[model samples]
Target: MTDTLIKVDLSQSAYDNDMIHNRWHPDIPMVAWVRPGDDFIVECVDWTGGQIKNDDDASDVRDVDLSQVHFLSGPIGVKGAEPGDLLVVDFLDIGAFSDSLWGFNGFFSKKNGGGFLTEHFPEAQKSIWDIKGMFTSSRHIPGVNFAGLIHPGLIGCLPSKEMLNTWNTREAELYNTDPDRVPALATLPYGPTAHMGRMQGDAAKSAAAEGARTVPPREHGGNCDIKDLSRGAKVFFPVYVDGGGLSMGDLHFSQGDGEITFCGAIEMAGWIHLKVSLIKGGMAKYGVKNPIFKPSPITPTYNDYLIFEGISVDEGGKQHYLDVHIAYRQACLNAIEYLKKFGYSGAQAYAILGTAPVQGHISGVVDIPNACATLWLPTEIFEFSIQPGADGPTIFDTKGIDVPLAKDL
Candidate 1:
């Protein structure tokens, strides 16, 4: 087993400095050839590509170049892969970048996509975590610590050139109509200047022009930051092109469900132990095109104490559309109001909310007029007082909950 494991390094090639770090052009040569049954151990770099160092501070965090994010590991060619096959990747285990365990979490510039709460906390701020053993400690927010969940924030294959073209055309149209829906060039990984990491040569230029921006979660699974995909998680990706062109990076020590404020989740570099295999004709069998996954066991130590509820609803039903953002924000506002009873101001509440072990969930989206989102928070972190339970608000938890599918299903 040891001899069968291939190692994929995360450094520049002799010819192209930005080969594996900044760009994601399918034309870039594959670093290694992984067979269907091959086991591999990948050495991945910090998502920032040497931009943010371990010893860096919050000021340094603010200075980070947005273009250099998501420094990934491979375009590792799977020996027997073809389009439409399911590339099943099993995450065996994950570890810290090296012996020195440290990571950073900060809010990105508003010029970028601007995290969910970007307007709430405009100035960039960060917490440097001293991650060791199984827990993470932060000096920025003292007296709170929690066990970490190690997982690749990004794990998937490249989309076909046709699909890429469709995405670009659609997004360009969206940009022309509503630019806010698309991230700014500062935040777009595919933007021209974004082919960063010592941009040189023609392939680099083409990649810079055509690389898929690693921001949204697409069918190709670029930056799907699902938190529960810790060690032992098995993921299935739809292969859109030959060899599957698989890549992985953006490792997170831990993250909540929403990854709410986005510039996110205990960002760190680590070793990824993966087993690659394939399910022939799986796309037709499952009738799905995006990545599918089975998460490992969840943290049993913490129990959800508060569940904030929100709906894409208002006094007038005009605003009650299918926009999840409306529901998500309402749920977040519920959490903010809940935090206010504990003596936190609105902005401070949103900032701390982003870092806290809180999760957001769309309980159901199929509702006719009102879609609902729930914000779950753990009571374990609060030492002083939490409203309603710790002598605070008169929040009646009962008579307010609705069972949507309970009645029909």
Candidate 2:
């Protein structure tokens, strides 16, 4: 662990890098090996594998293929690791590469990958944020700057073949229910675009056709996107295969809870300094079904917030019974409307909720006909005072400051 165990060439396509892969399968070979107690570095490309750029154009965000996403670094094998063991990972530190101090935040198109609130925002859009040491800001969205809560948006161990099959079967069943639905119910394996690290020819082909898409968080913890799992946090991951083929990427400089925008967060190309250990038979002992973690010891503190509440009622006034999803969406929409009162555009306000250290909570679910949800917008993130007053809201001169957009073709 004296040097970087895995390094990525940012200029190279992730599909061309033997150390990177987009699918998860036990057969995908580990690019490196490490024993318990080892500490090392692993570099990663942005989630879209550099598909999005620093420029203002959102066409790349609009045209990017969702199938070739989330290019991750490593299934780094750990010696003596076995199934049912817990792979204890300590995130010692994380940082954006000095050479690439910028990242992206965007909303995918409804026809492409519609997000949590896609119906309200049906088109593709993007905003680029420049990282300055521990803080980040975007020229596209004016009047705000804050410290980042950096973390890896996706990280986990490879699943056993049985678990992989279970994922495909269940997801396929759901997908089959609405095969032609926009944004898809589930992402199935696509062999042609799959990157089975270090595998070639027939073996690669066989694994690719069955490999699980790294789109959702499964039992082994792929793409959970928890903003609290940042540097200084520790995770206990369930190992389903020997060597605990651990892989991680999709780094973010900052992300609000829910990552409402599917192409959400201040996505970045960065490095993680981690230390690993094992707790043999700990999974069963702890009755763990999925990954668990301790919050980062060092994280951004934004206590002052403006909280917005929403019920299970839809935007069109259609009432639904105990639907947290719809409630949360309403809460997010409520916050965006509040931001607009201060002169921020709808898109810019939406982007802020996606990238800033905002908080969302399922406030109440047993309230009879309606579920209650709350969205907490950190007042401290804004330069101007956002607290409500007797004089109503103070509108800022936002004129031209706005998030970039790319209309669907």
Candidate 3:
């Protein structure tokens, strides 16, 4: 039988909200029926959902309402999707409809009160630029290549009532106990005062107000805009509710590593065409429970441990750099301990791992953690092999011997 797929248009009329959530309305009917392994195309409206016509200024950013800003398309139910299956979403293609502009005022930017840069620059300038030619103009510093990467900013499932209420009530109590905590919770545009008061009444009762949906996950799915999850990469997500209730939003054109500022290289909207498939009993097939699972192997063949040492040197005549020296020593010790976990002799591991492992250095300026190091393991040394009957081996159980073969090793 031929593969069945569906086509959705975010610009269509079937969606409920006209604001953020409506940009990629989920109410539209399927273009066609679909099953596992089917490929489909989806046409998306820009984040504005066609509300802000051309000639809109960057200040238009303020016009977006928080409640309706992040409109997503659909919870496209996957056929035969059970609570125990795995959904393998391959990002086949992503492109923008037109040139767009995303400035430093949105949720992802640090200009906001709760952002990472808030303390660094209490009063900072708002940066804005034209994204019309972003695809061609935007480039990684010192690198000649134009940027190209795609990741979803929002993707998740409907949560149960218990989970929803627990979060709401917790927030309310926290706010009431300490009003200063309000700034910490300002990541989004929700009405802070109203939320705090509502939470105070009855945390559990307030949970009944609205079901929770779209929580971020680090387990391997949903709003994990990891730069590595790009074209040609395979991602595995565990199925929770029936059909997995899958949806995708916050399509980013490109982003940097760590997503430090939380903003991507470019935030724009367009059509994202992809293929979806299922591995029947895939979750159990791979020993994963949650829909999100890490792609790395627990006991990798080659590994590197990283440590960062931040040193502050006082330029006064005394010449003190104690903090820097301590940080460096701590990093070295961390690396040694990390290598020992993989069956390396202290001296050998330090010598070999230090030379072979990938290293990264960064400068930490005023009011920020600085001077960091990263250890990278080459994928070639250790290959991911699935064992049908075992949870895999532990480094301690191995008694300090490296497993040579991926399977028996």
Candidate 4:
């Protein structure tokens, strides 16, 4: 048996675990040490750190704290890793603990953590997916089942104080531009909710006050949320400090290209089988400042897809110039509208797009006036035929089955 280097007690609060931390600060002590070529197992609580529940009623989702998230499993130090080297990681395998065979996906209320399509669907809602080996399905969403592409949604190394200052300064600049916007432009460091692993006293307090929130993907790759970076993938992460303090959590059983739902993906408590190595001076060798990766060779092939297109026009019929965000949002909205004709409520259709292996593409950007984006919905994931036919469409008989919702307070 491979040694379980850092084991988490999921039954306890993630904050109570010394092995877990929510903020990124170089001063936080490494919990474990390993050498290059070492392979081990590390367990993690779900991203919300056990706040979201297995039950229906998205009240938990609605009230969930956005700040206290992405509780990561390690600052596991690699013996020889240093700044400007690449800490190479191979995700040999990833699986849910037998005790946790389920996961939750939810849309956040716009007032809280708004999603990509927060305007169209602006309240907190949730769907629970039950995992059965390689496959998953939801009682909250009937007539849909698919194999998951499991992966860690967040992973990265500790930033040197200089790098950390750059992140805070740049993000704060964006936040100040529209500081009061709902969900804010960017999440800044907050001392109250930070979990600085083993750090204590004024040191922990100061670091927490400036530590970067694990919300957006940064230069050090904090939370990229890419679905393709799954089990079997090999990633080369840029080391920013000595020992290359690497930490990761936010395991997702399945998710689309963009986790369109804010409380997104089939979020679960899981473990990763990882092998770490070093690429000496590989940062400059590869011209890499951002993390680079080779995706998993093994993945589910949902070949047949019904593709939907959207331009940069907003829902209000206002035209935007080459905006990929607006274009993707329109594509998602179009898919939801089409699915509604097949008897799925908009929320169910939206949740399906979030948890399934859907694809979003930026097809055109140089075209004048509008950028074209496409949403590819896999037909195989659905039990019934979803293709357009002369018979128009078959209503899927959803039978009042819908994801749980908690109206925004």
Which residue ranges in model 4 land beyond 4 Å of their true spot? none
Q: Which residue pairs collide in model 4, if any?
A: none
Residues 276-368, model 1: lDDT tens digits: 899988888999778898987755267646888888864244577766777887788788777766555554345445655677888888977
**Residue-by-residue lDDT tens digits, candidate 4, 82-161:** 89999999999999999999999999999998898888888999999999999999999999999999999999999999
Instruction: Judging by lDDT, tell me the better candidate of 1 and 3.
Output: 1
Instruction: Give the runs in model 1 whose Cα sits over 4 Å from its true position.
Output: 1-19, 53-57, 179-200, 298-300, 313-318, 343-352, 355-357, 366-368, 384-387, 393-409
Q: Give each model's clash number.
A: 0, 0, 10, 0
User: Once model 1 is optimally superposed onto the true structure by TM-score, how far is the C-alpha of residue 399 displaced, in angstroms?
Assistant: 38
After superposing candidate 2, which stretches have Cα over 4 Å from the reference? none
List candidate 3 segments past 4 Å from native.
1-33, 46-58, 98-113, 121-134, 138-145, 160-182, 186-208, 213-215, 218-220, 284-409
TM-score of each: 0.83, 0.99, 0.54, 0.99
Residues 157-225 of candidate 3: C-alpha lDDT, one tens digit per residue = 433334445545665565566656523442222422111111223542333234333323423355565
Q: Give the Cα-based TM-score of candidate 1 against the true structure.
A: 0.83
What is candidate 1's CA lDDT for residue 204?
Answer: 65
lDDT of 2 by residue, 293-395 (tens): 9989776888888999999999999999999999999999999998899999999999999999988899999988999999989899898987889998999
User: Which residue pairs overlap in candidate 3's backbone?
Assistant: 20-68, 20-69, 20-71, 21-71, 26-73, 165-207, 219-292, 238-291, 311-324, 364-370
